[model samples]
Target: MSSRSLPRLPAAPGTIETGSTLKTLLDREAIDCLAHNLARVHRTLNAKAFRREAREGIEPLAILARGQHLAKVLRRHLPARYEQAVAVLVRSLTPSLSETEGNGLAGFFYLPHVSFVATYGLDPAKNGGRDPFEASMRAQYEITRRFSAEFSIRPFLIKWPERTLARLREWTRDPDPHVRRLCSEGSRPRLPWAMRIPAFVQDPRPVLPILEALKDDSELYVRRSVANHVGDIAKDHPALAFELCERWAEGADENRKWLIRHAVRHPAKKGVKAALRLRKLAAAG
Candidate 1:
C-alpha cells in the first residue's frame, strides 16, 4: 500500500506536524521512503523484499520499535559486511541540516538509520568486517548531522567506554555543533528515554571533561546539551556538578552563565541552597 493508505497519516496530511505522535513519523511512507533511498544509494539492494519486510506488521510498532524493525530489515537487505552497509547508509543521507532548529520531524526520517548503527554496528567481526567500531563512529558523525545518533552512540560508550570517550573528546572540537552536542548528550547518565550509562551515574567524573569542553560552546544547541549534562550529573553527584560549575563561573561569559543557571535549574527548584545561589549569580547572564 502507498503512504496515503496509512490510517494515521491523514491527521497530519502525509506529514508529522507538531502534535502528531512520534510513531506516526515512521508510517508506511517513511518505510517506503527509506527503502527507496537505500536502493537509490546502493543499486544492489533487494528493495522489493526490504520494503515488504519493513511493512509487514509494522503498523502496531511504536517509533523506536519501528526504527529497530527497519534496521533489522536493512541488515538483511544491505551488504553483509558492516562497513559497506554503513557506507551506503551514510551516502543515502540527504544532507546535513542547515540550521540548528525548526527542521521538524523531517529529520526523524533517519531514525531507522540511527537504529541500524546501534542495533548492528557495534562489533566488527560479528557483522562480517574489521574496523566496525570506527566505521560506526564515522557513520554516526554523518548521521548525527542529519538526525542525531545520540541514541546510537550509547551502546558504543557502554561496550567500549575508554575508546568511545576518547573519540568523543576529539569530537568536542568538531566544527558541527551537532557532533559536539552528541559528545555530551550521548553520554548523559540519566538521559531520558535512552539507556542509562550506569558508569556515569555511579561516578560522573569521567564525563565531566566533556561537559567542561562544551560549557561555553558558541551554539546554544550545544550549550543546552552541556547544561542538561550538568543537570544529570547534579542528580547523582551534586557536589561534583557544583565544583565544575563554580570553576566554570570564574571566566564565564553571558552564554556560559546562562548554561550554568539552566544546569542548576532543577536543583534550584527544589530550594537547594547551593543551586539557588548559582541561579542568582547567573540569573542575569
Candidate 2:
C-alpha cells in the first residue's frame, strides 16, 4: 500500500457548463419561483409580501448580497424567532430528493437554499442552543448536500470548536459523501470565498483528527475537500502539513496518495523543501 506501489487514482471530472451564475441563479424570476413553491407548503406565507420585499431593494445586489436581502425579507415576513423562521422555510421546502423534480430544492435552486441558512439560520441556530442547533444543522445539511454549507458551518466551528469538531468527526463516517465532505470542507482554515477560521489558521491541531478520518474517503468529492483542508493548513503551518503529507504518503493507497499530492501542492508551489520532497517521493514512487 505504499505510495509508489499504489495504483493511480481516477482523474476528477471536468467542469460542466450549467448555464447559471450567482446573479442569474438568484434573480427575480427565481425568487418568484421560490415564492410559488413556498406558498404551496405554507398557506399563510404572504407570497406577495415576500416577493415585493425581495424585488424592491434587490435590483443591483450580487448573489450573496441577494441572499442577504432575501434573508432580511424572510425575517420581516416569516416567523420572528430564528428557529421558527428556519422551521417555516423547512416545512415549506419539498421534503425529499425524489420530489425535487429536477428543479425543486435539490437541483439548480440548491445554492439559494444554502444562502437562506447562511443569511438567517446560522446566528439563530447558534444562539438557540448548542445541541439543538447542531441537530438542526445536521438536518439542514441534507439539503446542503445539493449545495454546500461549507461557508455557513465555519462560524459554528469557530464558536464551539470542541463540540463542532466532535460532531465533524462523527460526520466523517456519515453515509453521504457530501456530509463526509462537509466534515473536511467546513473546517478549512483558509477556505476560499468564505470567512477564515482564525483559530484553525493559528493552530490546526483541532481539525487534524477529522481530516485523518477522511483522508482515505471513498468519494473523490470528500477526498478533494480533505486535500484542500490540508493545503489550507500548509499556508500557515508548512512543517506540519509536510509532516502529515509524509506520514499519510507511507503505506497509502491510490486515494490517500492523491490526498497527499493535493495537500502538498500549495507548499510545493512555494518551493518549500519538505513539501517538494513529498511530491518528489510521490512522483518517484
Candidate 3:
C-alpha cells in the first residue's frame, strides 16, 4: 500500500505534542546523547524505505527514538494510554511495510520495545528467509524473553507440531547450522516471544529425543538455545529435565557441561551440584 493511501491512524488520546515530546527528551543530556548515537546508526545503515518514509518531517531518528521515549514518558504520565497508542501506530503502519522496509523499521526501533510489534505480528510476511517480519521477530526474540507470554507466541508454536518433531530429527545432518538451530530453538516452549505449547512444556517427550540427538551439536548458538529451552522445561517440570540431563551427561565436554547447567537453570542447588559432578565423571570417563 502506498504511503499516501495508508490507512488513517487514530491519534492516540492525550498524546503530548510531538515538539514537546522531543524537547522533554532532549533536555535529558544522557537521552540526547543516546539519541544522537542511535540516529547515527540509523543514518549509517541508510535503509532505503526508512529514509524515504522519514523524510516527511518526522525524523526517522526521532521516530526510532519514539518508543523508548514514549515508554518512559507515557508510562509515568499516562500508563493506560501508552501501549494503546503505540499499538495503534504500529498497526497503522503494518500495511505499508514491504519485507525489507519492515525489517528496516524493526532495526530503527529499540530492542526492549519489540514486544509492541511481536504482539501484533500483523505483517503478511512469511516466517523466514529474507522477510522483514521474520527478521524482526527473530531479532525481537533473541533480545527479550518475556514476550513468551502465551498470547503473543501461540500462533507460531502450534503449527505442524509433528513437522517440527520430524525436522528436528532430520536437521542433525542438515549441514546448515541455521536450520540446525531452528530445529532446536524453535521448538522451545519458552523461546522468548514464542507461545508455550503446553503439550511440549508438560511432557516434552517428543523433543527429549530431539535434544538428545542435537545435544552435542557442533554449533554453540544451537546448543545455547537448546540448553535454555531445556532450562525452561526444568522450571515447569524438573524431573523430566533432570532425566534428560542424566541421559546426556555420559560423555560431557565443556559444551555438554554448559548445556546441562543451562538446562537446569532453576533446579535445586543439590541438583545443580550433582549435575556438575556428573559432568566431571563424564569428562573423565
Candidate 4:
C-alpha cells in the first residue's frame, strides 16, 4: 500500500519507466479522475479546488508522499466530519478487482484514499474531539479491496494495538483475499516501505495468532503474506519463528511447505541451524 503490493513491488523512488515516472500515477489526468470519482459520490465536493491544490507543487513528490499530499487536499475539499468524508472516499472506489493476481498497477489509483485515513484517521482528541476509529476501520476494509490498506492500517495498530489486532483477527476469515492479505501484511513488524510495528518487533506473540489462522489460507496470495510476516518475526524472534514453522510443518501441504521455506529463507541464509533444518524439511515435504 505504501508503494504497491505483493508480487508488484512499488517502483523505486524516482524510478523512470520508458520516460514516464511512478509519480505520474497521480498526475493531472489521475487527479482529474480522482476528482471525478469523489464528486460523483459526494455532490458537494469542490472538485476543481481539490484538483488545483492536489496538483500544486505535487510533481516533485514521491509516490507515497504524493498520496499524503492529495489526502490533505481532500480535507480541504470534502466534508469537515470525518465519517461523512470517509464514507465518500469509500463509495468513490471503483469496482473491486475480480482476482488478486496480475492486477498490474491498476490498484494504485486509490492510494490517496488510504493515505487520507492513515494521516487523519487517528485520535479524535487531535481532531476536534470526534473519534475516527470505527469509521477508519470500515474505510480501510473497503480500500483494501481495491488498493491496500496495509500502509494505512499500521498507524491504527500503533495507536490501538488490541483493538486493531482484534479487528485483524476477524479479517482473517474475510471472503476477499486482499482483505485477508492486509491482516498479515498490515501488521508485519518490518513491512517494507511502511512503518514498523515496534510492539511486534519486540514481542511478536500478538501477531502470531493472526498468522496462524492464515498459515494455510485457501489463497496463495494470502499465504505468501503470512510467510513474509513470519520472516519479519524471524528478524526479531528466530526461535518463535522457527517454532511456528515447525508446527506448520506438521501435516503440511505443498503450499504450506512453500510458506515454511519462504518464512525461514532469510534466517537460513544467515546460518541459523534451526532455520536451515526447517528449510530442508520443507524441501523434503
Candidate 5:
C-alpha cells in the first residue's frame, strides 16, 4: 500500500512522543541507525534506497506497520535474492552473544534489527530462495539469543511444523532464556497481534511437549512465555489447559505456581468451569 493510503496509527500506551507517537520501541532514529549500520557492514547496501525508504511516509505507520514497510523496502533494494540479503543483515548484527547478558538501552538497541528480521527475513518465497529454511532457522536461533526471534520463528512453525517443533523441543534446554522463551512464545496459537497458527488452535498437541519441558523453567521470562502459551490454548480448549495446569500443579515449585496462576488468569476471568476449579485448587493450596 502507498504511504499516503496507509492509515495513521495511534500512539501506543507508554509511548512518549517526540515527533510522532513512539508506541513501538522502534522509532525513526532507530531505523536510521539500522540503515547506517547495514551500509557500514555491507558497502554495497543501497544507502540511498535504504534512507529514502526509511523516511518516506514513516510518520503515519505504527511500530509494527513501520517494520513491515521497512521489510518491503529491504526486499526491493537489498540483493535480489533472500539468502544473500539475510546473510548480510545477519552478519551486520553486533557479535553474537555467548550467554544472554546486557540490559538497559544496551539490550534495547537491537529492537529494530530484530523487528526487521521477524517481519521480512523469515519468509522463503518472499526471499526467492529454493531452500532457505535451514538458513532462516539458524538466523533465528542466533538472533533470538541476542534479542528475540519469537514472532520471526512463527512462519517456520507454520511452514514446517514438525521440524520446527523438534528444534523447539531441543531449544527448551538452551541456556539462553531468550531462546527458551521463543520455544514457547513462537508456537503460541494466539500470540497477540501476530497471525494465528490454525493447526495449533485446532489441536495444540504438537506444542504440548515444548510447554511440558518449560513448565518449571528457571527464568521468569521463559516461564511467562509458557504461561501465555498455555493461556492461549486455554482460550480455545479450557479442558486441555486445565488438565495441563493440574498436571503441572502436582508438586509444583514456586515458579510453576506463578505460571499456573498466570495461565488461568484469563480463563478464570471468563469463568470457565475448569479454570474456576483450578483457581479454587490454587487458592486452597
Candidate 6:
C-alpha cells in the first residue's frame, strides 16, 4: 500500500475548511498519487502537508511534515515551506528519470506543493532544498494567471520585505529565465494566490529599477513578467506606468512586445501609443 493511497497522519485537530476548499480545486488522483509517492519514500508526512496546503483550510502540513527530520536531510530550505522537500525529491527523482532531468516531473509535483502553501497561506516551516529563493520563484510560476491576477505581495512584504525585494532585484539578473521572471512576477500587485502587495501598488517606484533591468531581457518569460509588473503599476498610476512603457518602447524586442501586451491587459490609450511607437521602430529597423 503506497503511503499516497493511505490517509494523512492523525488528521489535524479541526474540520479544516481549507481542506474542503482544496478538494474543490485539486484533483483527488493527483493528491493521492503524490501522497502515495511520498509514502513509498517514507515521506507520507511531507505529502500530507503538501495536500493540506494545496486546498483552502487544512492544517499546516509543513509544520507537521517537519517532524520527519526534514531539516537534517537537505542542504538548503526555502522559507515558504515544503519547497525544500520538493527540491529534495526532485534531486532524488532526477537520476532515475530520462534526459530531461525530471524538470517536467519536478514542475508537475511542484504545483501541488505550491498550491498548498501560497494559496492556503499556511506556513511550512523551513526545511531543506538547493535554494530557498529559487523554490519560491518556481512556485509562483506554477500557479495560473488567475492567481497572478489576484496575488498580493503584502504578506510577503510585511513578513520579509527586505528579503523578498532583495531576492527580486537579485533574481532580475539570474541566469535562469524562470528565476528572472520571478523577479517581476512575484512582486505584481495582483499576483494571484499571493498576498496583496498594496505598498508596491501605492509606490511602485521601488521596483522600477528591477523592471528596467529586465525590460530587454533575452528570456521571453522574464521580459513578459517585467511588462506585467509595469502594467500592474499602470492600473494604479497610469501616468507613471505610461512613462515607463514609453521608455520600454524605445528599442524593444519581440519578447518586449509580448510583455507589453500582457502588461497592458487592462489596456489604455497610452498602451496603444506605446505599441504603435514600438511597431514603427521595428519597421524602421
Give residue 222's error in model 4 in angstroms.
Answer: 0.4
In terms of lDDT, the poorest run of 10 residues in model 1 is 5-14
Model 5 lDDT per residue over 1-285, tens place: 454332222223333457745334556556666676677657887777777877788777776677676777766666767777777767666655555433423333354445656665556676774677766777788777766777678777887889889999998998778889889988999999788999999999989999999888887878888999999998899888889899888887677887888899987888777887776666534
Cα RMSD to native, each candidate?
A: 4.3, 9.6, 13.0, 5.4, 7.0, 9.8
Candidate 2 stretches with Cα past 4 Å from truth are 1-21, 94-112, 119-132
TM-score of 6: 0.57
As a whole number from 0 to 100, the lDDT of residue 260 in candidate 4 is 97
- lDDT: worst 10-residue window of model 3: 96-105
Candidate 4: tens digits of C-alpha lDDT, residues 192-283: 99998888899989888899899989999999999999999988888888999998998898999999999999988889899999988888
- Predicted structure 5: lDDT: 0.74
Instruction: Write candidate 3's Cα lDDT for 70-141 as tens digits.
Output: 334322321133333233233322222222111212222232234344433434332222323343334333
- For candidate 6, lDDT tens digit of each residue in 1-285? 554454332222223364443322224444455455455545425655555543433234342233122222221222234565544333322122122122322223234344333432324344332334455544443332212212323455556667768766876676656556666777777665455687787888887878888888886656767777777787788778766766666667666656665666565445556545544444422
Better of 2 and 3 by TM-score: 2
The residue ranges of model 5 lying beyond 4 angstroms of the native Cα positions read 1-20, 23-25, 95-129, 283-285
lDDT of 1 by residue, 34-93 (tens): 776776668888878888898898888888888888888888888888888889988877
Candidate 1 Cα errors over 4 Å, as ranges: 1-19
lDDT of 2 by residue, 237-258 (tens): 8889888888888888777877
- lDDT for 285 in candidate 4 is 34
RMSD of 5: 7.0
Summed over model 1, clashes come to 0
lDDT sort, best first: 4, 1, 5, 2, 6, 3
TM-score of 2: 0.82
TM-score of each: 0.92, 0.82, 0.46, 0.91, 0.82, 0.57
Better of 1 and 5 by TM-score: 1
